[model samples]
Target: MVMQERAVRTRAALIRAAAEEMDRWGYEGATLTRICATASVSMGALTFHFSTKDELAQAVQESGGAYMTDLVDGVAARGRPALRSVVDLTVGLARLLQDEVVVRSAARLTRERPDGHSWTLFWLPAVRDLLQKAADQGQLRRPGEPRAVAALAVYLMAGAEARCRAMIGAGGGGDRDVAEEMDLIWELTLEGVAAGSG
Candidate 1:
């Protein structure tokens, strides 16, 4: 039992370390030696837990997907208006992007490694469903355009992720600023796209 527990801890630590390296330098730039050093584990230990860099990156993405699942579940639990839920989910994702290194790394990896599981798959379907609900509820200006609105939400998320990455790179702004900016953008989006905006 103890051995299994230790093995689990080692794997978790390695995932976090690899995520940090992957988040900062990207997959190609992140070295196994550096990941081993960051995790404080030997190369043998790392290899035992993760046979290759791709496996480690996939693990990081899975971890990040778990986080996204939790966030989506939490937002769904609130039972808010569908449009409101979409806004909340996107904003929540933005906050996660700013705060979680694992999530940041997963986002980067989803783009860099197209063959890997995408973290977006966890939450984007929920966003699309919410947009469809909004259309059903007469909350959208062009009721037939739920997919288009979902695409816009995708763009918003991509922009938010980019902004968070920039902030991390330049040591710019606080968490509150990212959330606030997203909130303002959502407000404008709602005004323009919601049912009756003359």
Candidate 2:
């Protein structure tokens, strides 16, 4: 029993270390040796858990996807207004990007490895559904254009990811809060940015 538990812990540690390494470096740049060293486990242990780097990357992506699925499920359980839920969902995603290395690595991997399992797949459909609900309920400026709104939400998420990466690269000393910023951005988006004709 103890041996099985230890093995499980080792595998978890390996996934975390791999996430950190991949988050810092792209998949092609990350090395199994560095991942094993970071996990404080032998190469044999790593290989026993995962035979190749590709397998480890897939595991990391799956972990991230699970986290996103949980967040989406939690938001849906609350049953908030569709537009409000979209806002909260984006904020939740941004917070995850800021705080979760596994998510950051998985997002990077989705971009770096087009063929890999996409972590975004977990939440994007939820976003689209929420946006469609909002449109049906007359919450959108153009009720017929949920797709455009969904694209906008995606852009916001991408910007949040970039901002978080910048903050992390700068040693995390920045004062700006991503969630607050996203809320304000969403408000401005709904209100429109162009100056009104007098």
Candidate 3:
């Protein structure tokens, strides 16, 4: 039990360190040696836990996805999430990326390198659920295909993420406005490019 506990602790430490290195220097540029150093774990320990740098990158992504998912879930668990929740999710994620070392690194790291197929598995089902609920509530137009609409919603959220990153990078003026614009964009990217003419 003690050994297992230590292993878990080691794994968490390594993931945290890898996230730091991955953010400052993308996956390729982040070396195992550097990660080990940041983690203060021996090279052998890193090798024991993660076979390769790619593996470490994958671990970081998994951690990031979990971290982000929990953040969204936490907010939603407080109430029935809204279109406002979607907006808050993206903006909150961007804020997390700007601040949280682990998640921030995970943000750019996943894009920097596509290691395993874990990302799709981790996110898809939740996205499908979100889409189905939005459609049922009439908060979203009935998409021709829920799966395709879910995918598009993910794409739109990515754009919102980029906007937040850009704004944060530029020193954070007008974040509320940018967030509002993102909310508008998400609303617009729905069933028909054209709205009802009535």
Candidate 4:
């Protein structure tokens, strides 16, 4: 039992180290040696857990996806208006990307991977579905254009993600800055989608 616990701890440490390294250097520049050094583990230990850097990257991506899924699920359960939920989810995700190195690195790795799927693939459908729901509930100003609104929401969230990633890479900014940006985004989005905003 002790051995298994230690192995799990060591693996988690390595994943975090790899994420930090990847966040700093991206996929091509992150090295196993640096990851091991950062994790304070030996190469043997790292190899035991992850046979290749690609595998490590995959792990990071999965971890990030899990985090995002949890956030999305939580928002979905809130029973809020679908438009509000979409805004909240996007801002929540941006905050996650801003604060979590693992998530940020996973996003970067996904971008760098040749076979990696787009992050939008994971979130866009949810956004579109929620937009459709909003329209069904008579929540949207343009009830006939849920697709257009979904596209706009996706573009805004994608932009926020990119901006947050860049800010994080450049050593981060105040949480207030992130909040303000999200507030502005929500304001604009609500103006476009609110029931009486026509």
Model 4: per-residue Cα lDDT over 1-198, one tens digit each: 999999999999998999899988999999999999999999999999999999999998888888888888999899788989888888887778778888878778888988988877667788889999999999887799999987877777677777886676577774546646876878876776567656
lDDT of 2: 0.91
RMSD per candidate (Å) reads 2.3, 1.6, 4.6, 2.5
Give the winner by TM-score: 2 or 3.
Answer: 2
Ten-residue stretch with the least lDDT total in model 4:
171-180
Q: Rank candidates by lDDT, best first.
A: 2, 1, 4, 3
Give a tens-digit lDDT track for model 3, residues 73-185: 77577565544455556555655655566776666775677543433344456567766776667675454456676666577656755765676567767636554665566
Per residue, candidate 1 scores C-alpha lDDT tens digits across 1-198 of 999999999999999999999999998899999999999999999999999999999999999888899999999999999999999999899988888889989999988885865667889899999989999999888999999988888888889988988887787665546767888999987787557657
Using TM-score as the measure, which candidate wins?
A: 2
Candidate 2 residue pairs in backbone clash:
none
Report model 1's TM-score to 2 decimal places. 0.92
Please tell me which predicted candidate would have the highest lDDT against the true structure.
2
lDDT of 2 by residue, 1-198 (tens): 999999999999999999999999899999999998999999999999999899999999999888888999999999999999999999999889888899888899988875975556878899999999999999887899999988998889989999998988999858898878998999888788889922
Write down the worst ten-residue block by lDDT for model 2.
113-122
Off by over 4 Å in 4: 174-176, 192-197
Clashes, model 4: 0
Candidate 3, which ten residues in sequence have the lowest lDDT sum?
Answer: 115-124
lDDT-best of 1 and 2: 2
Off by over 4 Å in 1: 172-176, 193-197
User: Using Cα atoms with residue i matched to residue i, what is each candidate's TM-score against the true structure?
Assistant: 0.92, 0.95, 0.65, 0.91
